[model samples]
Target chain A: MSSFRVVLGFELKEYFRSKGFMITTFLIAIIAVVGLSIPRFIDLGFNRSEEGSSSREFVTDNSRVIIYDRMGYLPPDELLQAYSNFQYAGSEKEVEEAVSEGSADKGFVITGPTSFKSYIYNADMFADEGAQIGRLLSYGKARKYASENNIDFEQFKQTLNPEISSESVILGKDTRGNYWYCYALVIIIFMMIIMYGQMIATSVTSEKSNRSVEVLVTTTNPNSLLFGKVIAGAIASLFQMSVILCAAVLTYRVNREAWGGLLDMFLNIPLRVLGIFLLFGLFGYLFYAFIYGAIGALVSRTEDISRSASGVMMVIMVVYFATLFQLSNPDGIVIKVLSFLPISSYSAMFARVALGTVTLVEVIVSFAVLLISVFLAGFLAAKIYRMGTLRYGNPIKLGVALKTIRRAKKQAKKLAKEQAKEGIETANEDREER
Target chain B: MLLEVKDLVKSFGDTEVLHGISFSAESGTALGLLGRNGAGKTTTIRILMDVFRADSGEITLDGNPFSAGDHWIGYLPEERGLYPKKKVCEQMVYLARLRGIHKTKAMENVDYWLDRLEISEYKNEKLEKLSKGNQQKVQLAATLVANPEIVILDEPFSGLDPVNAQLLKDVLNEMIAEGKIVIFSSHQMPLVEEFCDDIVILNHGDVVVSGRLKDIKKEYGENRLILSSDNYSMPELRKVLESQMSDIVKIDKEKKNFFVLEQKPKVTRERILGRLLNSSVKIEKFGVFEPSLSDIFVAKAGDEYE
Candidate 1:
């Protein structure tokens, strides 16, 4: 086997043998399974009894509502449409007394046709009982007006609230339908990059701090060690993410009917969009992981990792927030520009593919650019890793390391040119002698 | 097989560490690389192992250019370490596999080295759980698990008890007997002198002394004699020698048991002995002096001692 394979195998074994890794993966998967299966065990009230209905009757037992229609605009039967149990009170004082005495859950006094007074023993932040009573009073006034004019009440109601039958056919991407999953995928990629990037950096720094890097560098090339470590980290994180996501997706698919398709926008993802997400996400992760690995080698202690990798972390954070904010406007100029850049393209391009229009040529070019950046980052990381292996003290600056590599490259070119000139001269001498 | 390094020049940025130093080691023999701290020994070894490219140099195996990747080189670095949280056998096999050994063969090699080093029972234990001496043994096992053709040991005898040191000595002797080129680096001169046939002493990145151990000792020991008298103490012997042999020899060193004398120019050991016998001090021990490796090292590299 090649050295890269050997290193990769060893790193993978380390991750597999870690208890923290195994428990975290298993626990997240369980959480996903349970979270997706919640609708089956409890009624979330997303199911409607009849199709094309505007509202459903409140089904709570022992829940009472007291109403005092001062203007007599709302009928008790019409108020009953908003709540199943309604107590008609002659005075506002009676309505307030019933609510305060805990005999009623809520009380509404219609002081005017469009306005009302509400009373409750305890107010809930999400309660809309007053609004419901106001709507009912308005409808009752419309009915009373129709009766006085000798118009058909049903025809008047139909004229006021007409139902139009329409079907929405999306010719392009459905942003509303695909929004949740795209948001979820963007967060997933961002989290993977941060978590696994730190892991790769920590691994490298620990090896350096413990002095194991000396033996490692001698046993295998730095390129093999770095690339193997990064790839192994990526695979480990990808495995965990796949398990959790698959658990949620499969459980929801099995229970889609039980959920009444409520979570379809978040869980039912298109395979093509998912494919783009995987490809771009993997490349972006590798790009950052290589840089993290190089930063790891620059530090001599594990404590220095955070300080050294802060720059990369900042860039990742910027990309994460930018992609989230651009989800609603995937085809805007900002996202269009970011989609082609390797740093933000992992999420920006995926967002465009899911919710916005994108051409195949644009995707191909963006992917190619990202792939090349990954390779470049890997090569640079390997060089820096090799240079920083034996050095131990304060952490080396990234700028200084880059300068050194550039200078070395220039020196190597000069040396090669000198050697070529010497070879030519030696050949000329030999020819003349012959 | 012969491994030769010639004109190795290495620099780190503005400061040059190794300045065109050269040495050679052959199969079935051990070469001792002696140097004080910061004497560029590790730097040179790293260059030979391809950890760092030399600014300019020629390294060869037999007659062809040498690439460290093409050969299995067991390097026990001075800064010794393995994965502290990993099982001993697991990491040993990993290191061996990195050197191109297959899994089955790697496992076999790890078992063999662990058994040979008497740490077979601890093979499944984490490295951090082992005692320091046992950890050093595991490190040695890691170095030799690939059955490398060349073995480079830096301070291998450190942190070892007499018994463990003897075990390591026996293993090294066996490696040399099997015709493996062993480059032993240590500050413990006695251990190097015990097994090394050749030595190169580096001081400030310069080779101060390089040759066969026998020849270097012979060259340093010439015209020097050790004498001890039973009738008098070293001070008394020194006094007598100053009075009677002042014309023939000069007292170089005075110890509690013996006195070392340097002969005058063109003087012989026999002449010094004749002069010592004629003195009133009774002769107890008299012989031509053979310098120890430590003595030679101090003589050559002592000026820059911190």
Candidate 2:
């Protein structure tokens, strides 16, 4: 326990003092803030300039229909006045000129008392406010005709507004937004584990190459040292990630209006989903940290660190790409199997839960598998570490190292038993003599 | 015996490196663990430090199982290493703390050792920035910062100039004065002769010769006799010594009519002096010289010493 504390304190001190650590945290915070603020800043810039200078634009805000009396059929001023926010023009050329000069949003020419030709910016006439006005005017004409024919306006209005109600239900999946939110969380967790796992490996390799492990191992248990270093790395990474996450949330909060309901994407996520993300993320990092440290110990020099770490990286990559591919097919058989795999489960199982296609039992079983696997990895890595650190030369293959570790353990056990037997024999002889 | 190693065996893969090596060192004495390359001196020290496990062996300290943590065994491996980028005092404090010293005490010890080594000014300086000799002093300081009960130094004098070597020698003498079991390994034979009270000579992973330094020299007996004469040409003295002493194996000429006669069976210094006086070769200085640790090491281990 004291050795653990010593190694932990030393590792933390080194990590905290490192310029790389400080700079990376600061840079990540900056990036997060910038990522959240850029869209809001752009929106503010557009809103401020456009809103301040455009009263005429506001005139067009409510359809600003320029009606050209081409047929001279609209001589009724009261009728035009009753239709609020409608612009009227005398000649077709005048309305055409107004529409062409961008002063009006749309224009119209009344060919007859009940019909008219409409002008719009694009073919999406339903989207144009002026087109709505044209439709409303045509409806009014028909309503007027109906009144003259003694028809009920209430029933006609009721025809325009229906009372039917309907609801949407996805059979076995969550909302699309929640699915994407879960996927985003999974990707972040995956990247974090990979990045920090590499850091742990590199740190261990540096210690070994520097030959500090010799002094360290002699003074303390290698297993305790390994655990302490791994924990330190995990804590450091989580601290940095939290800082960046907080920065992002703060930036979004400050520009809440500009986010335009983007926060809702995350807010709607169930708190339990976030809890699962955290749980799986922690176990995943622990699992990879042990493997990385063990691999790091196998190497004799700094140059071999990356090569030694490549195997672990490959496993991580497989999990990552497979998870990504399963994102679209979250309920597929491939993902179902992948969710049970200790490595991929951190991502795949959480994703399945987020998609609302996974059961609690599945999550518990997967999490249990991962937790047990992490403990086993830590144990095996420590064994490998104890053996690998003392042997220096070419990088030891993992197979060879494991075999040596097994033999060493057996030898240690045999030695212990013999020592115990010897102690017992000596005790028996002494007792008899007495 | 403060530290006793018995029949330690170590093997790597199919081959055995250390073949039943055994030795012991007492408190307040410096044991020179002498060996050539691949002589298993390092392997043995590593096992003692508990960096590597021996295949089979028993090490006891004061009749108790000598664990790695039995005492703060200060070790300076032949492959001298430290965090080159770390400050001198910081790494020293860290290492001292690893040996179970408290933080504040570790800091104080670091300061004391740095000051004693005359490197207080470079306490906060990165080890890489220090001169090679000063760096060596810092390494030595690190090794002694914990005030270890048993200290193992392998080739501690390597890469050091004569002045720095003397500085290290003085520090080691201080360790001996403190009653520390200092196990030193070095290729500089004269330095070993000066530092070691007990000697273990390893040849090809085997303990070829080991005992109290004085006893080993005595048991081997004084095989080389040196004679410095005033009036005698080289040919004349050679003829006189050769004709009388048939046991003389080799005669090496030194400067100013000095000659060293290697004898198979020990010859009394007085008898040689009588013969020289009878031959009219007036002796200026005559003494039976005990073989040096290096000579003994070479004679026992053969021509493998580099």
Reference-based TM-score of each model: 0.91, 0.81
Proportion of true inter-chain contacts also present in candidate 1: 0.70
lDDT, candidate 1, equals 0.86
Docking quality tier of candidate 2?
A: medium
User: How good is model 2 by TM-score?
Assistant: 0.81
Tens-digit per-residue lDDT, B107-185, candidate 1: 9999899999999999999999999999999999999999999999888999999899999999999999999999977
Q: Which lDDT tens digits does candidate 1 get at residues A180-235?
A: 99998888888888887888888878888889888988888889998998888888
| Best of the candidates, TM-score | 1
Candidate 2 lDDT score relative to the true structure: 0.79
lDDT of 2 by residue, A40-117 (tens): 757634234344333321212344558776555553443354344567788888788887887776777887767777
Local error of candidate 1 at residue A336 (angstroms): 2.0
Candidate 1 chain A weakest lDDT stretch, 10 residues: A52-61
Scoring only the A-chain of each prediction against the true A-chain gives TM-scores of: 0.84, 0.70
